[model samples]
Target: MKTTRLAAVAIIANLAFATGTLAQDKELGEAVTIELNAVKSNEGGCTLTFLVANGHASQIEKVVYETVLFDSAGQVDRLTLFDFGTLPPGRPRVRQFSVPGIACDALSQVLINGAHTCEAPDLTDGACETGLILKTRTKIEVTG
Candidate 1:
């Protein structure tokens, strides 16, 4: 009987997550806006630039995100943690990621990873990533 109850609880949790009833989508991702800043490729490697803005009243320490880079042949994902030092409540900053040996042509798509790093100033809550607002300035595709 106990096992069945446990299973039922687990299923309900999953259902809640799938329905966006949790605070993950609604309360989070309100502090910052994420955008594609640029993408460069060369012998060195592929560089991806991103802009993160803090729209709330609290200063954020860093913006950590996961990115999925779909290349010509496969996909590459990375959890990028950038220390913005301090976003000062309403400022935006650009963070860069450089991956050697990967060219721009190989990149087919770019997706932002989930959940916030939750790093923030002492006076504010740490769920900065949850409060961030995500945006796309340009498509993550490369042209010859």
Candidate 2:
């Protein structure tokens, strides 16, 4: 009888822990989402497209990231700042950058090295890094 009670308590504790974890996961998913939407190669160069969404309560006036581009062989091609201007709350925006010399197929990874600018009146100091989610729809991988 004592063993049965202990088992029941253990099950209840496990269920509570699982519930808390699920809530945390859901909250994290609702944060800022940066998706590498597409990459196009033209005569000039390769244009990389990003789909950015702000899930915060306040609007971001400007946010820039020091981005690193990697070649197909995992070598660093170049580093540039991408200014995703004026991200409104709960809205998705598309931003594009053109590289004059890099081919679209040559890029295998993109990394958000750090935030160069994150301007918002009401946001925290580390607002740009907090709960940021990175995704990629193309073959190239993206990481923060």
Candidate 3:
């Protein structure tokens, strides 16, 4: 009886530790993913489409990311901020930015410099950047 009780306690303790580890992993995996979806060049300039998804439980009222555009020659083309306003939890949003005087083919990579703004009532500071994920469906490489 004593051995059985000790084994049961050990099992329970192991389960508790495993449960806590799983929760931490889940929290770390929950993040905002930004995907560079597409790029189109028109008579004016270029239009870049982005797919933004919020995986957090809280709603983000406003969020802006400073982005650096790199040319095909590996030179900085321009730096600007892209505002992804009102990101609801678990909802993917599409946003577009028009870059005047730059062709889509001229761009080679886009670097997410940092978060310019992250506004949410329930989120702590730096919440937008702490677990941010970057992706790209286009030929251009995206990095944070």
Residue 88 error, candidate 2, Å:
0.5
Residues 17-108, candidate 1: write the lDDT tens digits. Answer: 43332223334344556656567785768877665566666666555555566666656543344444456555555667787767776776
TM-score list, all predictions: 0.60, 0.79, 0.79
Which window of 10 residues has the lowest lDDT sum in candidate 3? Answer: 19-28
The CA root-mean-square deviation of candidate 1, after full C-alpha superposition on the true structure, stands at 15.5
Ranking by lDDT: 3, 2, 1
Backbone atom clashes (below 3 Å) for every candidate = 13, 0, 0
Residues 1-144, candidate 2, lDDT per residue (tens digit)? Answer: 999999899966754554344334445443677878778998868998887777778998999999999999999999999999898876667789888898999999999998899998888777777888887879999998
Task: After superposing candidate 2 on the true structure, give the runs of residues whose Cα lies further than 4 Å from its correct spot.
Answer: 1-30
Question: For model 3, how big is the CA root-mean-square deviation?
Answer: 15.1
Model 1 spans > 4 angstroms off? 1-29, 77-85, 121-126, 141-144
- Listing every candidate in turn, what is its Cα RMSD in Å to the true structure after a full C-alpha superposition? 15.5, 13.9, 15.1
Segments in model 3 whose C-alpha atoms lie over 4 Å from true places: 1-28
